[model samples]
Structures are given as structure tokens and as C-alpha cells.
Target chain A: MLRVKNLTVDHGAIRALHGVSISIEKGQLAAVIGANGAGKTTLLRTLSGLNKATDGSATWGDLNVLHSKPESLVRHGISHVSEGKSVIPELTVSENLDLGALWRRNRKESAQSKNEVVELFPRLGERLSQRADSLSGGERQMLAIGRSMMSKPQLLLLDEPSLGLAPLVVEQIFQSIRDLTNSLGLTVILVEQNAIGALKIADIGIVLNLGSIAATGSAAALRDDPAVRAAYLGF
Target chain B: MFEFVNTLLIGITAGSIYSLMAIAIVLVWRSTRVVNFAAGGIALASTFVGSTILEITGSFWIALPVAMLAGAALSAFIEYFFLRPLLKRSGDKNQEIFLPIIATLGILGIMKAVLHFIYGEKIGVLSPPLSDKGFIVSGESIALSPLRLLILGIVLLLMIALTLIFQRTNIGLSLRAASFAPEISRLSGIRVDLVRTVGWAISGAAGATAGILQTVNGSGAVTPEAFEFSLLLVFGFVAAVIGGIESLVGAVVGGLTLGIILAIILMYLGSSLVFFAAFLILILVLLLRPNGIIGVKGGRRA
Candidate 1:
């Protein structure tokens, strides 16, 4: 389980995340939907240790994740895929995936994990040697997710996976995320502006109006809610 | 024809040493977005250590490794103590690099002063370990000396070793990742700071080798105010710029090209025009390819 309580963060002088809290169960997909400047990305950054939490605490198992370094979070099986298409531009698709597995010392286990990642995003298998800059936006996102998965993490913190991607590509990528969560017991806290598509596959939905959560419920309930739909779902 | 061949041979040897130095400069730049003017100072210091070791032990074998270790240590210390804090203070997204560049210049000056303080008016020799007597080429005894051959061999071995390390190792993968994307790399469990330090240390070793080779290849003497040592840094930087300053292979190519051309100029033109010619070549290459000969807009840089 991954938990955040009263977590706060600042991007420069702006309070991007203000005392927000959320909980994600094992093997569950939690979609965090918000308008621009709603602190969705800040929440993930704080959880992943990229941004420090000024107040409150976050936990993944026994780790006090609020002040931990980013690398420590990965060691505890919590991998974070940052905002946008996050593949290393200079590294090949395969090398980017290999970087995710850098901390893994076991050669056989690393190789097996790599195989699983390629299988999950098989398009990556065909373009293994291509530079990540050559990857289309959607494929780059898949490559990002696949690279993060190379660590075989139990909890994955993903920021805006569907941003700048075609609907068809989004569908394929989200399907893979859903499948991974369902099959491998992987947990995901996906931050996205595309609420409807993300909520479709997510088990729980958390809506942020500004810096704090305005609503949290089952995905269907949030999807059906009039206010959330009018504001976020665009339906 | 024999004179031309000799000049080319000498050029190749000198270019090989510059390639090592250029590689050092490129490594430092790729790891930290700082152009280290201090690399040459570190090289001079390492060469001094080698000279001392030679005097003490009377063996080039022990002296070389010791100098490399000294270089690595000094570079790591500079990265940790000086560059890290300096970078942190000015490393905001819109961080201007002029301050860092100036800071490195100050470091180079300070290091040179310190070396002068320690070894005032003293001259130390880095006598070649191998015979410097050139093998006879058509009975003319051309410029391909055995010691020059040794320098070439060591440089080739290091380059090949570096290639293998960068391409075939986990640490290498982490180093590449860290340099490419520190945030993503950190999230992927790479200690980017430590990797940067390692990168500097490796550069230090390269600089040390270049220093030792260049000294022995020339007057075989190192002094606190050695003009050749300062020139090594300048030429190395020039070579790096020519190669596009972002690629190791480019650095090697640039170094060799610079060496060959400089040799040709010294022979055909004049010795005084060597530095002027280097500046010209750098300007011409930069004008033609702003990125460099092997420089690409994106990809693994070093």
C-alpha cells in the first residue's frame, strides 16, 4: 500500500500541493484528475522524492518516503515515471530500459524483467536499438512506462501518461497499464488531465480542484458525479 | 618524402596524446555542464607527482599509476568540494554558466600558484620509459621513436578500455543515464552526484596520462610555469571544440586532426603560427558545424 497524509509541496514560491492526501491499495489503479495547476504532478513528485514534502508524511511499506532520496524510493519497489515523455533522449530504447534496471545486480533477473517489459510494449521490441528521440510521443510514453517497469516495482507513480498522445495510442497504453496492474499486482497512481479515459480503467478516482483533493470515490461514482463530469470529465 | 613522413608520424604521436586530453575535457563537460579549465592544472600536478615518484622509486611503471591515482583523487575532490557547491548555488534552470567558467579559471590560476609555491625554480623530468631512438625508415632514422610508439599504444589501450566500459558495464549505463537525464536517472536508482564524481575522476586519469605523455614526448621536463602544460590545456580545449565538445569519439578525432594539422603547419608554415592555426581551425569548424564533426542534436553524448 502507498499512503500520503497531509502532504504539502512548493514549486518555487507557489504552493503546488497543499496538505493533500490519498491512498492506493496494492494492485489498484488510482487516477488523479485535475485541471491545470491543480497539484496533481506535485503530489507524484513529492511521493517519488523528486520534490520534498514541506509538511506531513508519505509511506510505502516501512519507508518514510517524504524525505527519502529518489533512488531509495526505487529500491523499495516504488518507481516513478515523471511528467511527459520521459525517456532519455540520447539512449536507445533498449539502453533506456537497461538504465531502469541499473540498480538490479542480478543479471538473470534483470534480463527477465527486460523481457517482460518488451512483451508488455512489444512495439519497443522492434525499435530496441532506435534512439528515444526517434520514438513518437506515444511510443516514448510506452518506453517510459516499460523502462520504469524494468525495475519490477510494486508501486509505479506515473505523471500524465496520456498527455500529447493520440486517442488510439492512449487506449493501447492505458490498456497495458490496466493489464499490468491486474495481472502482476502492480499499483499505479496515475496523474492525468484526460480524466475520462484514465477513470475508465482506474479502480479509484481522486479529483483535485486546486491544491487539495475535492472528491475521492470509486471510479464509476466519480465518473457519474455531475460536478466532476461537468468540470473534469468534459462530458 | 621522408621529411613529410616523419612529420606525419610525429603528428600522429602528438595527436594521440591530445586526444587523451580532449577526452578528459569532453568527459568533464558531459558530466557537469562546466568547461573545466582546471583539467590542465590537475594534469600538471599529476605529472609532478609522477616526476617525484620517478625520483623516489626510479621506475616509470609505479610512477604512472601513482600519477593517475593522484589525478583521479584531485579531480574527485574538486568536483565534491568546489564544483558541487558552486553548481548548487548557480544551478537554477536559467543558471548562467559564466560564473562557473570564471570560477574554474580562478581554480586553474590558484592551482598553478600553489604548484609554483611548492616547487619554485625546480624542474622535474618525466624521462621516457622506452627508448626514444627512432627506428630507421629507409635508413633515414625517421621520427617514429620507440617511446612515441609506447605513448600511442597506451593511448589506444585506454580508449579501447573506455569504450568497453561505456558499452558493456552497469556503471557505464548509469553514468550515461545520469548525464542524459538526472531526474529520471535518480528515480531509476542512479546516484547522479556520485556518477558525476566518477566521471570527473575518469577524466582526471585521462588528463594525467596526457600530461605524462606530452611531457616525455617533448622536453621531458615539468616546471610550475611550464608553457607546454598550459598549451596542452588550450589545444585540448580547441580540439574538444572542434569535435563538437559533446562526443568522446569527436574528441579523439578532433585531437588527431588538430595534431596532424599543427605538425604540418609547424613544418611547412612556421612554429609561431601553431596556436594561431589552432584558433583558425576551431573557428572554421565551428562556423561549418556548430554542433561539431560528430556532434548530434540529441542522443547519448559521451
Candidate 2:
């Protein structure tokens, strides 16, 4: 299980996150939906140790991960697929996947893990020798997710996975997410600006407004909530 | 035509040496986004130490590694103490892009002064105590000394080896990823700072090797009559630029081409035009191909 307790992040004098608290049980898909500048990315970055928490702590099980180095976070089995196509563009697809499994000491295990990643994302398999930059938008996202999975993380923090994708591609990605969670029992913290899509797929949904959580419930309840419908869902 | 062939072989050999030096520059540039102007300075320092060691011990084995180690340590210290602090202030528009360049020049001055303090003002010769023999082909003898041949062979091996590490190794993958996007690399569990340090150290090693080789060739030395060390740096800079600053091949090819051109030009313009010829060729290459002959636009840092 992952726990974020009263987490507050300040960028100099600017307060991006204010005393926000959240928790996720193992193998649950939790969504944090917000408008622009609502601190969704900040929350995930803080969780992943990219951003320093001004106050409070993030605990994965008994370990305090607040001040942990980003590299250590991978050993702890927490991987973040960042915003933008963060794939190493110069690295071949196989090389990029190999990097994702860098922490694993055993060469045989790492190779096995890579094969698993290729199996999960067949598009990556066909283009193993191609550079990451040559891939299209949808393919890049798949590669990014596949790269993250190369480490076999206990919890995957995905930020804006569906950004700038066509509707059909988005559907395919969401389906893959569903299948991954079902087959792998992978816990996920999905941050998205596409509120409706996120709410639809999330096991639990938390609506964030202005750097604070405004609402939290089951995904269905948030989808049915009248205020959420009026303000965000375009009902 | 026979003279041309001989010159071409010599040029290629010299170019190969320059390529080694350029690879170091490119490595540092790719990782830290800083072109080390003090590259020659660091190399000179290592060569000085190596030469001093050799003068006392007369052992090539001990001196060579000691020089490389000194270069590695110096490069690491420079990156950690000097450059790391500047990373925070990197985006300042007022500072201009040339600040790092100028700062490196300051480092160069400091390095020269330190070298003078430790080694004194005397120009020292470095003899590897090896066979200074050349192979004869078609009644023409090539000055293929064992040390020179060894140096050329080492450069080729190092280039191939480094390329494999970058492409196939896990750490190399992390390095490539980090150079592309630091934040994302951090998220993926890569120690970005460590990768940069390794890059710098490796580059320093190349510079050190180049300095030692030049000294042995009698082209790099410090003396009252001539400061060959300074000229070697100029040659290295020209080579780096000619190879397109970012291309490893460019650095080597540039160096060889420059050497051949200068050698031929020397026949006409005398020794005074060597530096001028090197820079002239470099400027021409830059004007013709801004990225260099083998330079990749935006991949692998260099």
C-alpha cells in the first residue's frame, strides 16, 4: 500500500500543493483528475521524489520515501512514467527497455524482463532495433509504459498517458491499462486532464480543485455526482 | 604522388589521435552541455605528471596509468566542484552562452600556472624507452614507432569500446536517457550526476593520452625557446571544431586533415603558418558544415 500524509509542496514562495492526503491499496487503479495547474503532476512528482515535499511524508509500506533519492525509488518498486514522451529518443527501442530494467542485477532476469515487456507491447517487439524518436505518438506512449514495466514496479505512477492521442488510440490505451491491471495486479496512480476518461476507468476517483482535493469516491459515484456532472462533465 | 600517399597515411594516423581527444570533448559536451575549453589544460597537467614520473622511474607502464588517473581525478574534481554549482545558474540570459567558455579559459590559465609551479619552466622530452622503428614499404620508410603505433591502436580500441558501452550497457542507457531528459531519467532511477562525472573522467583520460602522445612526438613540451604545449592545445581546439565539435570522427579526421594541410603548407609558408593553417581549415569546415561531417543533430549529447 502507498500513503501520502498531509503532503505540502512549495515552489519557492508559490504553494503548488497544500496539505493534501491520499492513500492507495495494492492493485487498485486510483485516478487524480484536475484542470490545468491543479497540482496533479506535482502530487505524482512528489510521490516519485522528483519534487521535495515542504511538509509531511510519503510512506510506501513502512519505509519513509519522502526524502529518498529517485534512483532508490526504483528499487522500492515505484516507477513513474513522466509527462511528455520521456523515452530516450536516441536509444533503440530494445535499449530503452533495457534501461528500464537497469536496477535488476542478474543479466538473465533482466533479459527475461525485457522479453516480457516486448510481449506486453508487441509494437515495441517489431521495432526493437528502431530509435525511440521514430515511433508515432501512440507508439511512443506504449514504449514509455513498456519501458516503465521493464523494472516490474509494484506501483506505476502514470501522468497524462492519454494526452494528445486520437479517440481510438485513447480507447486502445485505456483497454491496455485495464488488461495490465487485471493480469499483472499492478497498482496505478493515474493523473489526467481528461476527467471523463479517467473517471470511467479509475477504480476510485479524486477530483482536485486548485491544489486541493475537492471530492473523492468510487469512480461510478463521481461520474453520477450532479456537481461533477455540471462543472466538469459537460452535462 | 608517392609523397602524397605517405603524407595521407601520416595524416590519418594523426587524425586518429585527434579523434581520441575530440571524443573526450564530445562526451563532456553531450552530458554536461559544456564544451570544455580547459581540455588541453587538463591533458597538459596529466602529461606533465607522467613525464615527471617517467623522468624519475623510467617506467612507461606506471607513468601512463598514473597520467590517466590524474586526468580522471582532475576532470572529476572540476566537474563536481566548479561546474555543478554553475548548473543552477545555467539559464541566466545575462551571462551569455560564452560564460562557460570564458570560465574554462580561466581554468586554462590556472592550470598553466600550476603546471609551471610544479614542473618548472623547463621543456622536458618524453621518451617511452620503446622501439622507435618504422615499417618500410616500397623503398619508403614510415616512422611507425612502437609508441606511436600503440597510441593509434589504443585510440581505435577505446573508440570502439566506448561506443559499445554507450549502446549496449545498462549504465550507458541511463546516461543516454538522462542526457535527453534529466527529470524523466531521475524518475526511472538513474543517477544523472554520476553519469556526467563518468563522462568527464573518460574525456579527461583521452586528453591525457593525447598530451602524452604529443609530448613523445616532440610536438607537446614546455620550454623557454618554445611552448609546444600551447600549440598542441590550439591544434586540438581546431581539430575539435573541424570535426564539427560534436562528431568524434570529425575530431580525428579534422586533426589528420589539418596536420597534412599544415605539413604541406609548411613547405611553402614556413613554420609560422602552422597555427594559422589549422584554424583556417577549422573555420572553413565550420562554415561549410556547421554540425560537422559526422555530427548527429540531437542524439547522445555529443
Candidate 3:
């Protein structure tokens, strides 16, 4: 289980995340939905050790997630896939995947992880030898998620995985995110601007507005909330 | 015809050394986004170590590797204790590059001053390991010699080894990934700071090789303020820029191109025209391509 309390993050003088708090259970999928600049990415980045929190405490089990380095967090079974197509463009898909498991010493387990990633995203399997720059945006997103999976993290933090991707591709990626939680029993904190799609697949949804959590409930309840639908979901 | 062939051979030998120096510059640039002007100082200091080793062991073979190791240590130290903090404080903006370059120049000055303080009035001799006498071809003595051949062979081998490391090894992959996307690499569990240090170490080794070779290839002597070392720095930087300052292959091409053309100019025109010719060639290429010969269009700045 992962717990964050009273998390406040500042970008220089302006506060990005103001006293935000959320909890996620192991194997549960939590979606953080918000409009642009509502601290969606900031929240995720803080948890992943990319952003420093001005005042907050986050813990994954007994480990202090706030103080640990990003690389240390990966070893402790937390992986972050940042916004945009994050794979190294010059490296081949195979090489990028190998880099994800670079710290993993067991060759057999690493190979197994690679096979699992390939199975999850078959397009990546076909383009293993191709440089990532040649990959389409959708394929690059798939590679990003696949590369994160290579670390075999217990908790995965994904920021806007469906951004700019086609509807069909976005649907496919969302389904994979759902499958990761279901099949692998991995906890996920997915930040997205596509509230409806994210809410549909999420078990729990947190609606963020103006850097504060406006609502948090079961995904179904949030989907049924009239205010959330009008304001964020745009129903 | 014989004179032309001899000039070509001489140019190639000199070019190969410049390629190693250019490679050193490229490696540091790619990893840290800093144009390391201190590379020449690192090379000079390491070559001095080689000279000492040669004096002790009486073997050029032993001196060379020891100098490389010393170079690697010094380069890594600078990256860790100096460049890392400076970069962190300044941030990664492209416009902010000048400060780091200036910082490196300061380091270069300090290194030279320290060398002068330590080895003042003492010259380090680095005579050729093998015979410098030109190999006899037909009825003539060609410019190619055992020492020249050895230099070419070593450069080729290092290039091959570097290629294999980048292609086949995990460490090399991390180095590439860290340079390309440091944040992403860190998220992927790579220690980017450590990888940057490794890149500097490799660059140091290459620079040390260039320094030792330049010394032996010329007057076989080194001082704290050697004109030959200054020439190496200038030509190497020009070679890297001409090759686009990004790719290792581009460095080799740039080095060879600069070397051959300069040699030809020296032979046919005059020694005084060589520097002017280098600048003219660089201007011509930049006007034509804007990027070095093998540099990609709109490549990643970091």
C-alpha cells in the first residue's frame, strides 16, 4: 500500500500541488483526473521523486518515498513513466527494454519480464530491432509503458499515457493499464486528462481541481457525480 | 608523385591522432553538454605521468597504459567534484552553456599552472616506442614508419572497441540513454551522474593517447606550455566541430579531412597558410551543411 498525506509541492514561488492527499492500495488502480495545470503531473512527479515536496510525507509500506532518489525508488519496486513518448529515440526498442532492466541482475527474470512486455504490446515485439525514433507516437507510448514494466515494479506511476494518441490507440493503452493491474496485481496511480476513459477503467478516481482534490470516491460513484461530469468529464 | 604520397601518409598519421582528441571532446560534450577546454590540460598532465613511467620502467609500452589510467582518474575527478555541482547549480538550458565552457577554461589554466609549479624547468621526453625511420618502399624511403603504423593500428583498435561497447554492453547502453534522456534514464533505474563520470573517464583516456602520440610524433618532448599541445587542442576542437561535434564517426572524418587538407596546404602552399586553410574549410562546410559532416539534422541538443 502507498499513502501520501498533506503533500504540498512548489515550483519556485508558485505552489503546484497544494496540500494534496491520496491513498492507493496494493493491486488497485487509482486514476487522478484533472484539467491542464491542475497539478496532475506534479502529483505524479512528486511521488516518483522527480519533484521536491515543500511539505508532505509519502510512504510505500515502510520505505520513505519522499526522501529516496528516483533510482532507489525503482529498486524498491516503484516505476514512473513520465509524460510524452519517453523512450530513448536513438536506441532500438530491444535496447531500450534492456536498459529498463539494467539494474536487474537475474538474467532469467529479466528475460521473462521482456517476454511479458512483448506479450502485452505485440507491436513492440515486431519493432524490436527498429530505432524508437522511427516508431509512431502510439508505438512509442507502448514502448514507454513496456520499458517501465521491465523494472517489474509493484507500483507504477503513469502520467498522461494517452495524450495525443488516437482514440483507438488510447483505448488499447488504457486496456493494457487495466490489464497490468488485473493480471500482475500491480498498484497504479494513473494521471490523465481523459477523465471518462480513465474513470471507466479505474477502480478509484480522484478528481483534482486547481491543485486540490475536489472529490475522491469509487470510479462508478465519480462517473455518476453530476458536478464532476459537468466540470471535468464534460458530459 | 612520391612527395604527394608521402604528404598523404603524414597527414593520415597526424589525422588519426586528431581523431582521438576529437573523440575525447565529443564524448564529454555529449554526456555533459560542456565543451571541455581542459581536455588538453588533462592530456598534457597525463602525458607527463607517462614520461615519468617511461623513465622508471624504461618501456614505452608500460608508460602508455599508466598514463591512460591517470588520465581517466583525473577526468572522473573533475566531473564528480567540479562539473557536476556547477551544472546542477546552473541548470540545463542551452543558453547557459557558456558558463560551463568558461569554467573549463579556468580549469585548464589551473591545471597548466599546477603542472608548471610541479615540473618547472623539467621537460618530459616521450620518444617513439618503435623506430621512427621511414619504411623502404621500392627504391625510396616512404613516410610510413613502424611508429606511424603502430599509431594507426592503436587508433583503429580503440575505435572498434568503443563501437562494440556502445553496441553490445549494458554500461554503454546506460551511457547512451543517460546522454539522450537523463530524466527518463533515471526513472528507468540508471544512475545518470555515475554514467556521466564514466563518459568523462573515457574521454580522458582518449585525450591522454592523443597527448602521448602528439609528443612522440613531433619533438618527443613536453613542457607545461607546449606549443604542440596547443595545436592539438585547436585542431582537435576544429575537427570535432567539422564532424558536427556529436558522433564519433564524424570526429574521425573531421579529423582526417582537416589533417589531409592541412598537410596538402603545408606541402604545396606554405606552412603559414595551414591555419587559415583550416578556418576556410570549416566556414565552407558550415555554410553548406550547418552541421558537421555526419551530424544529424535537428538532433537532440542534450
A-chain TM-score per prediction? Answer: 0.97, 0.97, 0.98
lDDT of model number 2:
0.79
Candidate 2's residue-wise lDDT over A1-235, tens digit each? 8888788999888899998888888888998987888899999888888899999878988878898877889888999999876687867788777777776767898888888877888888999999888999899999999888888888889999999999898888887887888789989999988889888888998888888888889989999999987877778
True contacts kept of each: 0.92, 0.62, 0.90
How high is the CA lDDT of each candidate model?
Answer: 0.90, 0.79, 0.92
Error of 1 at B69 (Å): 1.3
After best superposition, candidate 3 residue B167: deviation in angstroms?
A: 1.3
- Poorly placed runs, candidate 2 (over 4 Å): B88-102, B128-148, B219-226, B285-288, B296-302
Candidate 2 per-residue C-alpha lDDT over B140-165 given as tens digits, one digit per residue, 9 for 90 to 100: 77656575677777778777877788
Candidate 2 lDDT at A230 equals 81
Candidate with best DockQ:
1
TM-score of chain B of each: 0.97, 0.87, 0.96
* Of 1 and 3, the candidate ranking higher by TM-score: 3
DockQ score of the complex predicted as candidate 2 = 0.57
Candidate 2 chain B weakest lDDT stretch, 10 residues: B219-228
- Which 10 successive residues of model 1 chain A have the least lDDT summed? A9-18
Clashing residue pairs in candidate 2 are B15-B256, B19-B252, B30-B301, B123-B222, B243-B250
Off by over 4 Å in 3: B91-95, B300-302
Top candidate on TM-score is 3
